[model samples]
Target: MSTGQATLPLLNTTLENCRMVIIGVDPHKDVLVAVAVDGNGRQLALRDAPARPRGYKTLLAWTAQFEQRLWAVEDVRHVAGGFVRCLLAAGESVVWVPTQMSSDYRKKVRASGKSDPIDALACARAALAEDLPAAVPDTEARNVKMLLDHREDLVGEMVRMCSRLRWHLHDIDPDFAATIPKHKLHRPKWNKSVQEFLARQAGSVAVAICVELIGRIQELAQRAAQLEREIAALVVIHVPQLLALEGCGPLSAARILAETGDVRRFTSAAAYAMHTGTAPIPASSGNTHRVRLNRGGNRRLNAAIHRIAITQKRMHEPARTYLDNRRAKGNSNTEAIRALKRHLARRVYALLKNGPDHAQADTTVQAA
Candidate 1:
């Protein structure tokens, strides 16, 4: 592929001395657009390639011209995962550029219109301006994430099937539908009862459909249970110390591990809290200094932390006492819970950072 030269010339002496190049990528299903920029964010060259193995090799060869180069790929993992893997495998330094940052940068550039090139340029500029995290190879965290996501999908499908079966049962036999417990359709005892009831029904279209739905739900439930067992085993191996925490269960531990991949990447606990969205945002105006709830960061990670906080408030004595102290200090229930979540984030960060040592120590302590 031919490379296009940009009109903007690199003039900054300091930036030129750095001799670093950033190549930003706008990835798509079929093709990828890349823009190469100097340390000063001055566009040097641009090219497009097919999103395939051959194209990846071609891009690698093309990028070889820049000795000190870093790839700034937009954090659209679904589209860029393969390319990122390829780059990492080739020992290339890469960083993920958040889509929001790239979009905001593009908006400020006064570009006439939007295109792959413009987006790629924005990614390059954003990378130059921000200290983004370096992308690393997928580890057990990816495996756990995949398993957890699959289980969730199966559970969702099972719920839908249960709803359809409930309606069918209601239409055929309201009395039986009334007897069936709500929200327990996945339970083996309840599922067995439903199957037995379906068998006694006279052969009909609705009966056949109900039978099919029940079978699908059972299958989904079984598969989801298998995935859960696998995920729990992984969590036990990876972060057993997380499970030792009062409110965190196997699934919660798995989620924490999956979302906060390589927690050591974070410089400190505060950084980890900021990533989890537990860190409050500053919203002060001069003398009226105040902080607001942070609604950014990884919402899924935030949700996992919230789940732990809620469970702790309900049953964990230490957590309950902590909340009481916060309330005694004039914090509202919501504010107390928010503070508790931030505290959990720091604990979780510590557990992840010292995973191996903490896991061994926890195991030994438990055995003793």
Candidate 2:
């Protein structure tokens, strides 16, 4: 992995059937830099392309000069999205390399200072080392995630609007502020001041603003409700088994499916767990052996798993019984919850792949 040490004999041997050239892309808002490398990670061709349709075509034409090519894209959701999608649409093979992977190997791959081209080269080198999962676009899952995001945004807007209304109400009338509905953000019942101001045509703008804000807040609430109904319907059609699970509801199911797109990308349940940030890490030395909380994987996935674990602990008898059994075995509350989340992660992985799974919480128990 030295600066010029091309020829990854180990990876190259296994990747003999791979394309002749691996295109490494470092995408940016304004422009992108791509490096074409051989299986041995030797630099073949490098170019800077604009971040536009023409740039994409230009980059493709340049890469076409090479015999066979594969794309190694940085796993940036929005930034690299255009480039990756374009490649995929053209019926080309695309490999998603975590953005951090380039940073991880930047020190050893670059010659002097770091630039777009250098980072691109580093990405190419990293690509030769690991055969990353291909990027497969799933439209249904993507829509569910978008709806969830919009719903979250609407909820946040409602909160801010309510806070704003409360701030004004608190100054004008404390009692009125207290009466504002928490859910609907309704106007106060005893709003004589607003009425008086508007009736006298004095400072009616304030009334108009509050009215407008209230109207918007109410509209957002309605929209959010509609989105929930839609989200639930989509989840039911796409993944009903998750809803059948005692813990996962519509929002929970959407988040899980959206975040963990195409579980086949993950080789096994362990890999999926690792992605969820729940996989155990080694903390052992000498005769003692132990595992620690993995702070690595996707925290959002980990959080979704945490919510499921908590819900199951409360209502699901099997989940609660498993928790009690673990607690009885000298496991602390945190440890037991961690074990439960890992189990749920695997169950989720399985359920997402197909539907109506028979997997249960008890099936995931592992030895301490």
Pick the TM-score winner. 1
What TM-score do all the candidates reach, one by one?
A: 0.84, 0.77
lDDT scores in order: 0.83, 0.75
Query: Clashes in candidate 2: how many?
Result: 0
lDDT of 2 by residue, 25-86 (tens): 88998898999988778898889989998999999889888777778877766788778888
Worst 10 residues of 1 by lDDT: 359-368
Give the Å shift of residue 365 in candidate 1: 20
State in Å the error of residue 29, model 2.
2.6
Candidate 2, residue 194: Cα displacement in angstroms equals: 12
Deviating ranges (above 4 Å) for candidate 1:
1-18, 40-42, 100-109, 112-114, 328-330, 360-368
